[model samples]
Target: MPGFPAAGPPGGPQRSSAETYAQVQASPEFAALRRRWRGFIFPVSALFLIWFLAYVLLSAYAPGIVNTRVGGSNITVGLLFGLLQFVSTFAIATIYSRFAEKELDPEASRLRAEVEDSL
Candidate 1:
C-alpha cells in the first residue's frame, strides 16, 4: 500500500463517474443544453403526434373528406396526408439538425471541454 498507486496512474486523483455526472449536471451550460433539447423535442413531438392522430381520426371517421379527389388528378386528400407524414418527418429532422448545429452543439462542445479539462 505504501509503494503502490491508490487506484489510478498516480499523477492525480481520477474522477469517479458520479463526480463527473454531478459536475456536468451542475453546469449551467449543461442545463441549457438539456433545456434546449427538451424544449425542441417535446413540442415538436407533441405537434407531430397530434397531426398524425388527426390524420388517422379523420381518415377513419370522415372518409368523405379524406377521399375527396384533388384537382382532377388521381391523388386524394388521403394521399396528400399520407405523403405529408413523410414530409413532416423529414422537415422535423432537418429542423432538429439545424437547431442542434446552431443552438445545441456549441454549448455542448463547451461543456464537454470543461468536463475534459476538469478531468
Candidate 2:
C-alpha cells in the first residue's frame, strides 16, 4: 500500500470527497462546462448514429443502391459509405481533441486546482 496511490484523502472527520465534488458540480462553471460537453456530444452522437444506421439499413434493404458503382469506378456506394464511417470517426476525434484543448482543459484544470487547494 506504500507505493499505491491514495484512494482519497485519509478517512477522518474532515469533509467527504463526495461533498467536495458535489460543491464543484453545483458551481456555475461546472454547469456550463457540462452544458458545453453535452451540447457538442449529444448532437454529434445522434447524427453519427443516424448516418451509421442509414448505411446499415441501406445495405440490408437496398442492396442495389448500396452496390451501385460510383462514376463507373470499381468503388461501390457501400464501400464509400464504409470508408466515410472511418472518416467520420477520425473527424469526430480530431474535433473533440481540439474542443477539449481549446475550451475544456483550462476550466477543468482550474477546477482541479481548486479542489486540491481546498484539500
Candidate 3:
C-alpha cells in the first residue's frame, strides 16, 4: 500500500476543506463580496452594538420615563425602546436576507463555481 499510494478518502489530505474554501473565496465574485464585507460588516455590527448600548444607557439614566405610568402600569421609554430592539433585530435580519439573496447569493454562486472548477 505504501508503494501503491494508499487512498485516504474523498477530499483528502491532498486537498483540505480550507483549501477548497480558499479556492472558492479566491473567485472574482467572492473576492468582491469579501471586499464589500470588509466595508460593511464591522460597521454594521458596531452600529447595532452601539445602538444596544445606547438603549441600555437610556434605560438606566432616563429616570422620568422609567417611573412613568402607561395604562396604570409602568412602561418606560427605555423598556419600549429596548423591546423595540427585538423588532429592529428581526427587521435587520429580513433586510440582510433580502440583500444577500438579491445581491450576494448570485455572486457567491459564481464564486463557488469558480472554486469547483479550479478543483
Find the candidate with the highest TM-score and give its number. 2
Worst 10-residue lDDT window for candidate 3 reads 1-10
- Root-mean-square deviation of Cα positions for candidate 3 versus the true structure, in angstroms: 7.6
lDDT of 3 by residue, 13-112 (tens): 5655567676555555556897866666677788889989888776678767655666776675666776889988988788778878887788777665
Clash pairs (backbone) in predicted model 1: none
Q: After best superposition, candidate 3 residue 111: deviation in angstroms?
A: 0.8
Best by lDDT: 2
Candidate 3 Cα deviation (angstroms), residue 106: 0.6
lDDT of 2: 0.85
lDDT (C-alpha, whole model) for all candidates: 0.83, 0.85, 0.67
User: Sorted on lDDT, highest at the top, how do the candidates line up?
Assistant: 2, 1, 3
TM-scores, all models, native as reference: 0.84, 0.85, 0.68
In TM-score terms, candidate 1 sits at 0.84
TM-score, candidate 2, is 0.85
Q: What is the full ranking by TM-score, best candidate first?
A: 2, 1, 3
Q: Candidate 2 lDDT, tens digit per residue, 1-119?
A: 22112335666456657777777888888899999989999999999999999999999999999999999999999999999999999999999999999989998888887776665
Evaluated at residue 88, the lDDT of candidate 1 is: 99
